[model samples]
Target: MTDSTKYLQALEEFILLGKSAPGAAAVANIQKCISSPNCFVFAELLELPNVQALVNDAEHKKWVEALKLFAYGSYMDYKQQKSAASDSLPDLTDLQLTKLKQLSLITIASTEPHRLTYPSLQSLLDIPTTRLLEDLIISAVYASLLDAKLDTANQRVEVSSTAGRDVAPGDISNMIAALEGWSASCSSVLTEIEAQIASIQASAVAQRKEQLAYEKLVEEKRKTAEKDGSKGKRVMDHSDNTGFGLGEDEMDLDDGPFDDQGGARKSRKGGNKMFSRKR
Candidate 1:
């Protein structure tokens, strides 16, 4: 429903299609998407570890534009001249030139030595299936990193696209091994992060419990003080009523006569009588 969700869905569909599509169609599709401005802008701002992973036929063109704009600057025309002079094949064909161009776009953006590596792109210019596959993997990994979605454990350090396309058992084994290696790396990093979070949570819980205990002890002390104060007040009131040393004039008793014979006193107003006894 949301724009972001729509884009994400589109991206997922595109990825699925890319995986199943023939290599030539996949490259074309990815190139077309990369050429669009929206995809280009998104790739630029993405913070993932491998930015190249997300590019389809559409997104790769955007990256090319970025390379052209910021990396190329005013020396765009000179790139071919430089490449021709450095490259072994001065008479490289049109197809080779196109491949060189693509490689130039990528190498300029990459950390590898551009002058030395552009020739390889030149070498693979005509092949629609194999070279493109290598580029696709490279692009996917790069994009994933740039988009903040790249898992290092999923990285294939020695991924070579030239392996036979028939899907042999050995190929499957190699693929599984590479993927397992990548997953292990990712799992280790994830575990470390989880451990740190758990430690912090435990520390916070302990601190809170200690604080509660301290507060409870303070409350108990306050209650005890109040009880002691009340009891002392009661004792003082009792001592005052006994008239141990104070004169009777200081007392608030009503006018009443006590016989020397110590006879009982009764209320004359009603049958119910209220009385106090002196020590």
Candidate 2:
């Protein structure tokens, strides 16, 4: 069975039993249901016709109001009611008192996770010391009422989570406001994350464009260098051809047969002879 199945089943058992029971017997059923350690909610039992009849009874009407208190009111509320009209309210057993105190932790610690200070809870629950307060908090934790730890150094109860209680009268508006505030905070954080992602993408695109431009410039310079080198080689080849032709003509005259008078001469079979006189 589920964690709350047994508790609700026990409560439902009482409700069904009270339906057929007489007025006084129904009151007894309510008392037993509230006093059970497993049971917490009493709204259904409170609505029974037989149970409601006790409201008119002067002696037993207190049981109806007392069950309402256990269903919605905190332990502090119990104390206040008991103080005001001790004669009219039904007495709570040890289990009922302890359970109410645990349930009261949910109310006091609901607004903020870590807002309940040692003095505040102690005063509300009638706990005399921080040690006793811690024990109560531990008991509530063990019962799955709330997740909390004692902040001994700070003298506070730092609550992390709590079971949701039945929405008492006057709580709907506050709950809605709290939900709206949380939604707004989440939206703000999401926008910041999206902005950061956009910035990173833009930076990457700019870097890629810069890299491509640099590569294009380098390729152009390499092509220009190769063109200039080819043109210089052609000019060198032309100059070498012209100089070679001129050197050959000079060598023919100088290396030709020399006349007896020590003068230079160039002999050709098909053309006239050329001679150079000695200086």
Number of the top-ranking candidate, with lDDT as the measure: 2
TM-score of each: 0.32, 0.70
lDDT of 2 at 234: 35
RMSD of each: 18.4, 4.8
TM-score of predicted structure 1 = 0.32
lDDT of 2 by residue, 1-279 (tens): 754665578688898898898778988898788778777677788888998899988988998888877777788878888899897687888777878888888888875444499888888888898888888899888877788877899887888888766665577798799999999999999999999999999999999999999999999999999999988873333245446423333443335477666754545433355556657
Question: What's model 1's overall lDDT?
Answer: 0.43
Q: Residue 49 lDDT in model 1?
A: 22
